[model samples]
Target: MASVAFEEIVETFDFLEDWEDRYRHVIEMGRAMEPLADAFKVPATKVDGCASQVWLMAEIDGTGPEAVYHFKGDSDAMIVRGLIAVLKALYDGRTVAEVLDTDAGAQMARLGLDEHLSSQRSNGLRAMVERVRSQAAGAAEGV
Candidate 1:
């Protein structure tokens, strides 16, 4: 199940039938995010496969499978930053097990992202999801 924060976004999306309105809402969400610090934007946090420069930094608390997952991300492109915001809603503050178990594609599909996003954006989104999952899995492994 998605977090209450994410459910709120889903409800907002449902109310905003126009994709353009939804798109603007996404950008606004991105704009609202606390900016990722310049110090954390190094090579290790940088994500591959995105057309734009993207970075994700994870902070895992606790240990093993029960570890809690949290992250901050940034992107050069406004839309991609928005995508990162969407991802944050989807994955942040969950246990590593929950993060690992989330069917991201299915969840994103609920927002009609699969239909509205460009192919490149879709691939970028997948890459971002992979990065989050990898971090969660690593936490689960006590890495």
Candidate 2:
């Protein structure tokens, strides 16, 4: 995960000349992802709106304003798993405030996700982002 920094991903995507290459890169990232544990795959964690089954877990690491975040996730689809990798790259190990401030949709857009993804996939991606955003907000509000 440390190797797959968000800025590095952006640069790598920029270097690739074709969507085919980009897709391969994405799939590779997904393949490299650490799988979510069976215990974490609960109904409450399952993401809505995804055409493929997906589970996302977001946890706070500290108290009050100092709280940090960690995320773990999985998806049945390779592309969606790769999309999760993209989210991980952007948000994992960040402070809750940092996670809340991050515009993951805009970040994905910079990678041309809107141009390349299907409508269903796009919606699913949004769902995943909202889930993470909600997690951060909930932590901030002490929910």
Candidate 3:
């Protein structure tokens, strides 16, 4: 969780220098992710309104200041899973407040993802982030 570096992703994109290459890199990111267990694909973990099926689980480590939020997620579509990877890079293993503080839309724009992706993919990506924030909110409240 939060394992990928933003700078590394930026460098990879910049080096690829073509939309097709960048697109492949995104797909590879998803392919490289550790597989989510099938049990996590249950209805309770599903994120609503995505064109592709998506599931996410938020595990709060503890109740105190040291609490960390770990997220596990998956998507039926390759691109969507890559988008989930982006969200995980920004959010997972961080405290709930830290996850909430990230400006994900700005992050996407900075990555130039907004220009290359389809509207449906963009909306689905936003839905993933919204689900993460909502879960983080719940964890923060519980603490």
Candidate 3 off by > 4 Å:
1-4, 64-66
Q: Which stretches of candidate 1 lie over 4 Å from their true place?
A: none
TM-score-best of 1 and 3: 1
lDDT of each residue in 1-143, candidate 3, tens digit only? 22357667877787888889888888888888876899889999998878999998888897643468888888889988888877777777888877777788887776799999888888888888898888877777774
Query: For residues 1-143, could you state the per-residue lDDT of candidate 2 as single tens digits?
Result: 22248989999999998999998899889989999999999999999989999999987898654588888999889999999999999988887888888878778888998899999999999999999989988887777
Candidate 1 colliding pairs, count:
0
Q: Give the local distance difference test score of model 2.
A: 0.88
Give me the displacement of residue 7 in model 3, in angstroms: 2.5
Writing each residue's lDDT as its tens digit, candidate 1 over 64-118 gives: 9999999999998988899899999988999999999999999999999999999
Predicted structure 3: lDDT = 0.81
Which regions of candidate 2 deviate over 4 angstroms?
1-4
If scored against the real structure, what TM-score would every candidate get? 0.98, 0.94, 0.90
Ranking of predictions according to lDDT: 1, 2, 3
lDDT of 3 at 31: 82
